[model samples]
Target: MKFLLPIFAALLLSLTTVNARAAEHGTAEEAIALINKTAAYLIDEGPERTFFEVSNPRGRFTYRDLYVVIYDLQGRIMAHGMTPRLVGLNAMEYRDDDDKQFVREMIERAAKGQTGPVDYKWVHPQTQRLHAKSAYFRQVGLYVITAGIYK
Candidate 1:
């Protein structure tokens, strides 16, 4: 009976921690705000400094599960907050689980000077699982600034 009680306590603690982490995930509004903030930063600081800061995993551009990704007009990744390794790659042909060419779509939208949310499935950085995600983006000059929230 004593062992069962301790097990129950541990289970409760685990659930509590998981819930707390989930609560830390960013919201849709927050994602949009972050993208706007990144756009401003890019304008004020230019790509050199802006990309450096955004690529930093612990930088202000990354909060909770929301991170910034900067893509050039040509669909090349200029900076990435979550995965720095993808910074120099071209994700134009990248597709989600549903075979949606999300990166290409984002580029096309940005090229037309649009700002809004792009819905797609992506692997959550925290959960490492496929989850529905909506990324908010804005075109700043020749670059697209984006931030997303996992649903």
Candidate 2:
């Protein structure tokens, strides 16, 4: 009975640690909310202003492990909240570690007037390691606004 108790305690501790780590990162709901907010901002403030704000590393569009990224129909980066240097770059040919052209897929989905999540592998900014991620995106005018959470 004593051995079983210790095993149960260890299992409980492991579960708690996993939950804590998950809480430290962003969630799917947060990503969707950020995407909606970015889209609304873009519609109201226009692309030039919106893009500048979205590209600001310390902007409101960035929080936790999530950030907004705007792309045109052709997969050109319009703004990137986490990496402003990515702005104005064409990401159509960019691929994940698994050779998945996620940017190109995102462009295709957005062009079809789709609004949902796209699962792929990407380098996590905080960890600097490739991790599974799911980005929620929505098509707004000529651009697609996205925000992702690491899973």
Candidate 3:
């Protein structure tokens, strides 16, 4: 009957909405967990080993689309999870598509001895499309470590 068809369509729509919400992957809490994990690894293994692991694509520091980046107090990149060539680059002057001074804020937060949560638009390595990303940074000893979630 015509009434049954509408009811079926409405049920299908509701199910799709539920699936969409269930598929939500990354969150700020996930970024915090990543930062904490990197910090523990940094303390346990030191920068040399930790940096290597963080930059490793198959390493433990990588999960889903989240990756770690390490920097010094002066804002020079020490390690990057998605791009190893970025290592040794001073990216403090870099800006996002929206001209957001994300790296600068990361350094500022680290210098102040607090965690930084900077949001910007960046090209996702996997999709090669620009997406809204939120990166969190923490100062550990003489270095800073950051991880981000793509929203």
Candidate 4:
């Protein structure tokens, strides 16, 4: 029965692999849907209301896990998600390569009227922990949503 036991274990491993793959696909789909929803809201509400109105509530509700930013065409931060201290702050002053790159990429894509896909390995400012984040940018708009999962 040793041979039978080995075959059964292999089957179990295969099933686990399939389940993991399905879960990943499901997560990607959900991420895409979230970006789309945020984009639609931005389009309908416009930047003024989006940044001033929606941000306050979301920041109040899920303040810790989310960091929202709205930038103008000139790459100036107009609003900050949870941290009000960051409002009117300039990301251009950042010295770190990863942080700068993240900002640059978001602006570049936003200019093209595109929303970037889920970006992983983002770093938190206060905690300095590695984070998995999704960045959504809409062109010439009032807001960008960045959701970070702590690692």
lDDT tens per residue, model 1, 28-141:
889988998888898999999999999999998998989999999888999999999998999999999999999888889878877767899999998899999988888888
Clashes of each: 0, 0, 0, 1
In candidate 4, position 26 carries an lDDT of 23
Model 2 is weakest, by summed lDDT over 10 consecutive residues, at 110-119
- For candidate 2, what's the RMSD? 4.0
Residue pairs clashing in model 4 are 47-142
TM-scores for all candidates? 0.95, 0.85, 0.82, 0.53
lDDT of 4 by residue, 44-149 (tens): 8776666664356364323334445666555667666656566676664443335445666676676676766536455665456655655555554444454333
Give model 2's clash tally: 0
Question: For model 3, how does the per-residue alpha-carbon lDDT over 30-83 read when each residue is reduced to its tens digit?
Answer: 878988999998999999998888888778887777888999877888889889
Report lDDT per candidate: 0.91, 0.89, 0.85, 0.55
- lDDT minimum window of 10 residues, candidate 1: 109-118
Question: Which parts of model 2 are misplaced by more than 4 Å?
Answer: 1-21
- Which residue pairs collide in model 1, if any? none
Candidate 1 vs candidate 2, TM-score winner:
1
Error of 2 at 42 (Å): 0.5
Question: By summed lDDT, which 10 consecutive residues of candidate 3 come out lowest?
Answer: 18-27
Inter-residue clash pairs, candidate 2:
none
